[model samples]
Target: MNGGDPPFAQRIAQVSESHTTRIFTRAQQMRARGRDIISLAVGEPDFDTPAPILHATARALADGRTRYGPVAGEPGLRERLAAGFEGFSADRILVTNGAKQALFSLFQVLCDSGDEVILPRPCWVSFTEQIQLAGARPVLVDTDAGFQLDPDRIAKAVTPRTRAILINSPNNPTGAVYGADALAAVAAIAAEQRVWLIADEAYHVFTYGDRPHVPVLGLSPAPDGVITVRSFSKQFNMTGFRIGYVAAAPSVIQALTRLQSHTTGNVCTFAQYGALAALEMDPALIDRRRVALRRRRDLALGLARALFTCAGAQGAFYIFADVSAHLRAGQSSADLALRLLDAAGVAVVPGEAFHGPGHIRISYGCDSATLGRAFARIKEGIKEGL
Candidate 1:
């Protein structure tokens, strides 16, 4: 407090401002000033919410399906979500506002004060923050050169206080998908150590190449303590609907449900209908969308590689480029990111936000024309010593 009174909860102070939202807000302010900026920093898919989902939600509202519903999620939506994961049924699914909430709840359910959660480096920024929010320490393990998991490193990080090992396949920023062997190795370690294997499959639908996205729970010698989280945001372009679900052991699901009852309560009751519609969507839409993302990935990667030696991205819609050579004196990745946003009218994320300095993240969720223009500006900016 300003005077000699108590201040806000010190716990919240432990949370850092989200650098991605900070950059996003700045880009928005610049746009309000009439700048024709091309934003390559946003994480959401650029596609509008699909028609079937929108129609289903509209029908839901029209049919008066809008009261408070079950805290664990409506049975229909939970049943549909549960069907996708092996060994899970409706009783084992707890739908939350988004995958983000599901993750936060998982940490709360599993972690205690001073407990540790091992997260791979250059992982999603929220994972660390959420672990802290649950009064736990996050032990970050650096990945191998390709941004893939180093199971050996993760294995070494475990201690008696370790509560979970969190992995995001097709990892954010770097876009490297961990193969089946890598996942199985990690699961084995979790099982042997009796630690929870937290699998984030938010980008499961966006994996590229012949190797498909594998759910860690399905791998051989499956751990009884696996917790898998997925969302409708990326796959169905339902960002605003705020619907996602978690599949875990029935006991874990019950704990999440009880915690959620006193916490966020049920996700918007009618929004569940939209999620229901998404599960039944034509499989081809996903295929076509992935093909389009592959094209953008190729286009953006080619441009980024010309200036910096960036390897090909395997999945997700981001290209992480090492820009160490382009930095002026004393400039961190965040500095270069803001500099380009100001000078080139283009927006990209700084790698330091992802615990990676000397690198920048470019989201290619926009159309080809926007990507072409943004890259052209970037090239010109580099030529001008920006």
Candidate 2:
């Protein structure tokens, strides 16, 4: 153990540090230093967890429900969650630590060394790392200029080693919602190629205008080999609860449950009850959140368009703006994001991490007033960059 201890494994050292995390960490540091930093870097709702859910968790703990529960999740919560989709049952749902864990474990089960997962960029930051961790290759294919999925591009990226195709609607970072036609094309491609199709619909409840989040599982005939991953984080402000579930064939659930039995097992026992309470929440409350997010989206988009070229933000509470026009002298998106943090006290995620350089992802989950001020600072910051 000499020489500063043995070197860590190559796998651990070779992984890319998440750029979003870098920005988030820096913002936290600035905040600790008493800086008035406005962080739009983290993908979390600013809203409070609904009161009913909090009370439910409290009640569960009081009832001696703190002990470890089923690895496949509490049957009550699973049954409730499954009720939304026809044919889904508690036996077919395996709740995990988070949608993140569900995704990670799914990849581990689905891919092996050199197996390829077709990913459309700019994607969520974790997809590549998760695929890599599973000993698989993340074959990234860039989206169209408007950030929409081009099925032809996906078709071209597929190969014999392809294990799955991962898609996110109301996607993280870019906030682009893939259209039904495009998803259907992908569904056909997955079935024809005999590969898995994973749909991360974590932001399904936040779609705007005519752009609705379509689950691949709900597609007509619902192509085989499809796995749908969802989380309570965004919709219910349950990020801290860490409850997310996956819906697939019963066989997939069995496999995940087996893996879960060895891994973290069930999510917090009481947290599952909180999630059940969340399901019982009035839909009106959700509508209000969506309304608020839609307004914030507009405010952020208006400010972004004034400074840089950006596509229509259809879903998710983010604006993926192209900052290349304002970038000067070899400044990558990360550099510009850093400059925004330092110069304007505003924090945003660099699009480079999402495989879309010269762009930035601005989360509008902040309050409207905060968003207004942040956007003002962003305008000034971009001006300074020019």
CA-only RMSD, every prediction: 1.3, 1.2
- Count of backbone collisions in candidate 1: 0
- Return the lDDT, model 1, position 49: 85
Poorly placed runs, candidate 2 (over 4 Å)? 220-222
Q: How close is candidate 2 to the true structure, as a TM-score?
A: 0.98
Q: Write the per-residue lDDT of candidate 2 for residues 1-386, one digit (tens) a residue.
A: 56788778877775899998889999999999999999988898699999999999999999999898989999999999889878777887889888999999999888889999999999999999989888889999988988888889999999999999999998888889889989889988888888999999999999888588888776735444889899999999999999999988888898888998999977899999999999998999999999988888888888778888998489988788998877878779888898899989999998889998999999889888998899899887766652
